[model samples]
Target: MEPPSTCPPDLDGPTIDIVVADPGWHRLIPNAGTIVRRAAHAAGMEGTIVLSSNRVVRGLNGRHRGKNKPTNVLTYEHPAPEIILALGVVRAEAAAQGRRPAHHLAHLVVHGALHLNGEDHDHPGDARRMEMAESRILHRIGVPNPWKRA
Candidate 1:
């Protein structure tokens, strides 16, 4: 297993940002953030990893993507000026899925962090690489392969 990257004086590893105004967002922010931050750390990203959720599904749908009463998870990730790993999780969907909010949160966190680290699944080959990487990362951290369960 790759060792967690060290934080150099000139480099920062993922910073967390919480932007969800909805009071109903997950209480386990730290839990999810820790999982994602560690994963990003393992991936060798030298930046801040922000953790947050969203509520304006309409605006998100129009700006970010999709408009189907929101989604269980969404991540807006990019490099430069610090990476924004926005995680928007629909609380109702989590409840409907009978998942512990924390699990869903952890999954989204890893997913977003991976994106910031340049991992993508836009195509079959890319997806396979991402899923395989995610599976290995999640497994190492004791979380089941999220895609495998889904």
Candidate 2:
């Protein structure tokens, strides 16, 4: 898909190179790159987001995070900034939260982009700040706050 001509001017949007490794997910998310780019722009970051399957994300989580489990999203920042979103986890979380899958995906993209930009939740104070930033970014894009209780 082509990039949007009118992105927010305050931030230099990222060149989001997206790779949809899952055919089913490709069909599920039509404009995945656009979503990633907008989220990155909101976070004032530049990166890549790979919309992948559960297995690929699980392997990445295990190798990188040492969790040995599938996760909704993973961010890498050393070699290059990149975010990986697992379709399976995203879909499930969205459903559980009664939110549209696309909205949840966008939230995760923003969360991952923030991580790429040095935002972390390792401590309570840092996590609160990160969550506030995520909420603000998502709100700017008209997405509901993901942290709000149901």
Candidate 3:
């Protein structure tokens, strides 16, 4: 998802704040705080977080599309004067995909942070770049490569 250009160009703070929300599937996920903080740090962002847990029936991956049902992970950005990362994840979706919710959440947080910095994946090339970057970052933290391209 693209960052919403709601942030004004001028703000007093030189730091970007991180806001995290639990998307309502605690049953499937854990260690949300550490995951979110790690993402913010990986993206070179510093600040407060105002995150929320959400319920997403529509799968953002569209992997199953009109067939299998929604899968985990969604990124929303409120761009600007003070950047905000709106990271959403479907805990159930993660479980259904055989993914750990914490891992999925971390991926989305990083993805959301990238959007705030103008990274996009609408095209194959862009997605590849994003995936590679994600793979590298996750690797640094001892997480397996998250990129399907690899």
Candidate 4:
């Protein structure tokens, strides 16, 4: 993995726990815990962030989202707030979008955090608002807006 990416210093916010369920995550993004904490804090969320494999994520997706495919990220609110990310899917998407894997991972973490906080992109208006919030949060944490075209 590339050297751990730099992130702003931690600030006062909700406490978050990061669980690296898959060792492969280290090969995709170094210092992932820092990224997840910063992004989750910026999104004003507190929860467990699970860095998992594609197979595990696919099973969760199929059971929860009704799609038998590995998604970049997924968030759950029941029992406790939790966000799951698939390393392979995240890395591939980052490569496809020509973005640094760390940046994409941060974006998805923030996205999942927003979802847990009641930000939904199911409709166009909602999507715009959610994207704007994401851009704001990402910018605060030094990541470029994912919605902005290069």
Candidate 5:
């Protein structure tokens, strides 16, 4: 169940490069690059996505965000705009939140792309707007509302 190397033909949007460093999680997410590309197109952004392990994400968090913990996703703008996803954190969070891994991954990709597009959730209003946009994009992709209570 290796992830697809290329995006779907219909997804004619921004280019995305998905580098999966964790082989175990690779089977869990098929067509991950397509998902990220769709989200980026929906959010009107162009970037890359790195699908990695929790350890890598944790290290990045400690160095960049100063949080010193693994997060589901992180978006960075320097060197090159890109989104880094921690598969372990994403799987755990999705299970806890009762979301399918694919759906949860879609949500995170959309969230990261939004951040790359300058959408921030640091404030209540901004958060609301970003969430709404995420919902809309997810809906368009046929994924259920990730924020909806299970």
Candidate 6:
């Protein structure tokens, strides 16, 4: 099902819809929607963000990407812009990297939003360009550069 509604007008950017399929996401990061919305706005993207579990994400990944693993974030820009994030994978990645879940979530949203905005990292040059864009967007929201993580 879709979310209750998209982000409010105060953000002053693209419209971002947020769906919290897994309520437990709050336990991992209470302001997941806010973080996502802010990141999406920073990237100047309008889309839907689904906060779901590894099980849900794995199913989608298998059907869509032919991969049978739970990924952190997936972006679809065909019919419309949409981003899905798996709570389990995101939390684990954050812990493994010694970073806050909130920061990681923001970074992922920006990354996915960039994808929706036609950014790809398939080549070295493209990767650098996308990384730089992600860094700038994240910095605007006060998130550190994920690439510079120790």
Best by TM-score: 6
Off by over 4 Å in 3: 1-28, 47-50, 55-89, 148-150
Colliding pairs, model 6: none
Give the range where candidate 1 is weakest over 10 consecutive residues by summed lDDT.
1-10
Q: Could you tell me every candidate's TM-score relative to the true structure?
A: 0.59, 0.85, 0.60, 0.90, 0.87, 0.91
Model 3 residue 149 lDDT? 29
Clashes of each: 10, 0, 11, 0, 0, 0
Q: lDDT for model 2, please.
A: 0.80
Tens-digit lDDT string for candidate 5 (1-150)? 455243334445566666666765558877776676676677676767788889999999999889999999999988888888898899999898878898899899889988888899999999999899999988988889876766
| Model 5 score (lDDT) | 0.81
Compute the lDDT of residue 130 as modeled in candidate 3. Answer: 84
Residues 1-150, model 4: lDDT tens digits: 333233344466776778788877776777887888888888888878888889999999999889999999989999999999999999999999999999999999999998998999999999999999999999999999899997
Candidate 3 lDDT, 25-99, residue by residue in tens:
233444555565666567655444444433232433343245333323334444432322223434554566676
Steric clash count of candidate 2:
0
Estimate candidate 4's alpha-carbon lDDT, on a 0 to 1 scale.
0.87
Once superposed on the true structure, which residue ranges of model 5 sit more than 4 Å away at CA? 1-11
The lDDT per prediction is 0.53, 0.80, 0.52, 0.87, 0.81, 0.88
lDDT of 3: 0.52
Q: Which 10-residue window in model 5 sums to the lowest lDDT?
A: 2-11
